[model samples]
Target: MSHSSTIARRTTPGRLRHCRTRSERGAATAEYAVTIVAACGLGGILVTLLKSDVMLNALKHLINYALKLAGVEGLEL
Candidate 1:
Protein backbone atom coordinates (compact mmCIF):
# COMPACT_ATOMS: atom_id res chain seq x y z
CA MET A 1 0.00 0.00 0.00
CA SER A 2 1.16 3.53 -0.78
CA HIS A 3 1.64 6.26 1.88
CA SER A 4 -1.43 8.13 0.66
CA SER A 5 -3.65 5.07 1.11
CA THR A 6 -2.49 4.64 4.70
CA ILE A 7 -3.11 8.31 5.47
CA ALA A 8 -6.59 8.16 3.94
CA ARG A 9 -7.47 4.99 5.86
CA ARG A 10 -6.59 6.59 9.20
CA THR A 11 -8.86 9.61 8.49
CA THR A 12 -11.81 7.65 7.12
CA PRO A 13 -15.35 7.84 8.53
CA GLY A 14 -16.10 6.19 11.94
CA ARG A 15 -12.49 6.67 13.01
CA LEU A 16 -11.35 7.92 16.44
CA ARG A 17 -10.48 11.31 14.95
CA HIS A 18 -14.10 11.69 13.84
CA CYS A 19 -15.32 10.61 17.25
CA ARG A 20 -13.36 13.38 18.98
CA THR A 21 -14.98 16.15 16.90
CA ARG A 22 -18.38 15.62 18.50
CA SER A 23 -16.94 16.00 22.02
CA GLU A 24 -15.01 19.19 21.14
CA ARG A 25 -18.16 21.36 20.87
CA GLY A 26 -18.64 24.07 23.54
CA ALA A 27 -14.91 23.87 24.44
CA ALA A 28 -14.46 27.59 23.67
CA THR A 29 -17.36 28.54 25.95
CA ALA A 30 -15.82 26.61 28.87
CA GLU A 31 -12.52 28.43 28.38
CA TYR A 32 -14.28 31.83 28.21
CA ALA A 33 -16.10 31.19 31.48
CA VAL A 34 -12.86 30.29 33.26
CA THR A 35 -11.13 33.48 32.05
CA ILE A 36 -14.06 35.69 33.12
CA VAL A 37 -14.09 34.18 36.65
CA ALA A 38 -10.33 34.76 37.09
CA ALA A 39 -10.59 38.37 35.85
CA CYS A 40 -13.42 39.13 38.28
CA GLY A 41 -11.39 37.74 41.20
CA LEU A 42 -8.36 39.87 40.30
CA GLY A 43 -10.50 43.01 39.89
CA GLY A 44 -12.02 42.50 43.32
CA ILE A 45 -8.59 42.18 44.91
CA LEU A 46 -7.33 45.37 43.26
CA VAL A 47 -10.44 47.32 44.28
CA THR A 48 -10.03 46.23 47.90
CA LEU A 49 -6.41 47.33 47.88
CA LEU A 50 -7.21 50.71 46.32
CA LYS A 51 -9.92 51.34 48.95
CA SER A 52 -7.58 50.73 51.87
CA ASP A 53 -6.51 53.64 54.13
CA VAL A 54 -2.81 53.33 53.23
CA MET A 55 -3.50 53.56 49.49
CA LEU A 56 -5.86 56.49 49.99
CA ASN A 57 -3.24 58.32 52.08
CA ALA A 58 -0.63 57.79 49.39
CA LEU A 59 -2.97 59.16 46.72
CA LYS A 60 -3.70 62.19 48.87
CA HIS A 61 -0.01 62.83 49.38
CA LEU A 62 0.64 62.66 45.62
CA ILE A 63 -2.18 65.12 44.92
CA ASN A 64 -0.94 67.51 47.61
CA TYR A 65 2.58 67.44 46.21
CA ALA A 66 1.38 68.11 42.69
CA LEU A 67 -0.68 71.09 43.88
CA LYS A 68 2.27 72.46 45.85
CA LEU A 69 4.48 72.21 42.75
CA ALA A 70 1.88 74.20 40.84
CA GLY A 71 2.07 76.74 43.68
CA VAL A 72 -1.57 76.43 44.83
CA GLU A 73 -1.77 77.38 48.51
CA GLY A 74 -3.79 75.78 51.39
CA LEU A 75 -4.21 72.18 50.13
CA GLU A 76 -4.56 71.03 53.80
CA LEU A 77 -2.06 68.17 53.32
Candidate 2:
Protein backbone atom coordinates (compact mmCIF):
# COMPACT_ATOMS: atom_id res chain seq x y z
CA MET A 1 0.00 0.00 0.00
CA SER A 2 1.11 3.56 -0.64
CA HIS A 3 2.15 5.80 2.31
CA SER A 4 -0.79 8.25 1.72
CA SER A 5 -3.37 5.39 1.65
CA THR A 6 -2.07 4.00 4.96
CA ILE A 7 -2.18 7.43 6.57
CA ALA A 8 -5.74 8.00 5.39
CA ARG A 9 -6.92 4.66 6.85
CA ARG A 10 -5.36 5.47 10.24
CA THR A 11 -7.00 8.91 10.45
CA THR A 12 -10.54 7.78 9.55
CA PRO A 13 -11.31 6.08 12.90
CA GLY A 14 -9.87 9.00 14.89
CA ARG A 15 -12.17 11.43 13.09
CA LEU A 16 -15.26 9.29 13.83
CA ARG A 17 -14.33 8.83 17.51
CA HIS A 18 -15.16 12.48 18.37
CA CYS A 19 -18.66 12.30 16.88
CA ARG A 20 -21.79 11.38 18.96
CA THR A 21 -25.19 10.03 17.97
CA ARG A 22 -28.14 12.35 18.76
CA SER A 23 -29.79 9.88 21.16
CA GLU A 24 -26.63 9.22 23.19
CA ARG A 25 -26.23 12.85 24.32
CA GLY A 26 -28.15 14.11 27.38
CA ALA A 27 -31.08 16.60 27.10
CA ALA A 28 -29.48 19.42 29.09
CA THR A 29 -30.06 22.05 26.41
CA ALA A 30 -33.78 21.27 26.07
CA GLU A 31 -34.24 21.27 29.84
CA TYR A 32 -32.50 24.63 30.20
CA ALA A 33 -34.61 26.18 27.45
CA VAL A 34 -37.83 24.98 29.08
CA THR A 35 -36.80 26.33 32.49
CA ILE A 36 -35.91 29.72 31.07
CA VAL A 37 -39.22 30.07 29.21
CA ALA A 38 -41.22 29.09 32.28
CA ALA A 39 -39.38 31.60 34.45
CA CYS A 40 -39.95 34.37 31.90
CA GLY A 41 -43.66 33.59 31.72
CA LEU A 42 -43.98 33.65 35.50
CA GLY A 43 -42.14 36.97 35.62
CA GLY A 44 -44.49 38.41 33.04
CA ILE A 45 -47.52 37.39 35.09
CA LEU A 46 -46.10 38.93 38.27
CA VAL A 47 -45.37 42.21 36.48
CA THR A 48 -48.90 42.29 35.06
CA LEU A 49 -50.40 41.91 38.53
CA LEU A 50 -48.15 44.64 39.96
CA LYS A 51 -48.93 47.02 37.08
CA SER A 52 -52.66 47.02 37.92
CA ASP A 53 -52.03 48.43 41.40
CA VAL A 54 -49.88 51.26 40.01
CA MET A 55 -52.48 52.08 37.34
CA LEU A 56 -55.27 52.18 39.92
CA ASN A 57 -53.32 54.58 42.12
CA ALA A 58 -52.65 56.90 39.19
CA LEU A 59 -56.31 56.93 38.24
CA LYS A 60 -57.35 57.74 41.79
CA HIS A 61 -54.98 60.74 41.86
CA LEU A 62 -56.33 62.02 38.52
CA ILE A 63 -59.91 61.71 39.74
CA ASN A 64 -59.10 63.58 42.91
CA TYR A 65 -57.51 66.39 40.95
CA ALA A 66 -60.52 66.65 38.67
CA LEU A 67 -62.91 66.74 41.59
CA LYS A 68 -60.96 69.57 43.22
CA LEU A 69 -60.85 71.58 39.97
CA ALA A 70 -64.63 71.30 39.74
CA GLY A 71 -64.98 72.81 43.27
CA VAL A 72 -66.73 69.68 44.61
CA GLU A 73 -67.11 69.28 48.39
CA GLY A 74 -66.99 66.22 50.73
CA LEU A 75 -64.11 64.53 48.85
CA GLU A 76 -61.82 63.63 51.77
CA LEU A 77 -58.29 64.96 50.88
Candidate 1 accuracy as lDDT? 0.89
Q: What is the C-alpha lDDT of each candidate?
A: 0.89, 0.84
Best by TM-score: 1
Q: Which ten residues in a row have the lowest lDDT in candidate 1?
A: 14-23
Question: Model 1: per-residue lDDT, tens digit, 9-76?
Answer: 88787686546566789898999999999999999999999999999999899999999999998975
What are the models' TM-scores? 0.58, 0.40
Model 1 lDDT at residue 19 = 64
Task: State how far residue 69 of model 2 sits from its true place (Å).
Answer: 36
lDDT of model 2, residue 1:
100
The C-alpha stretches of model 2 lying farther than 4 A from their native spots are 1-21, 24-26, 54-77
What is the C-alpha lDDT profile of model 2 across 1-77, one tens digit per residue? 99999889877987879778788576778889999999999999988875897876877788888998899867943
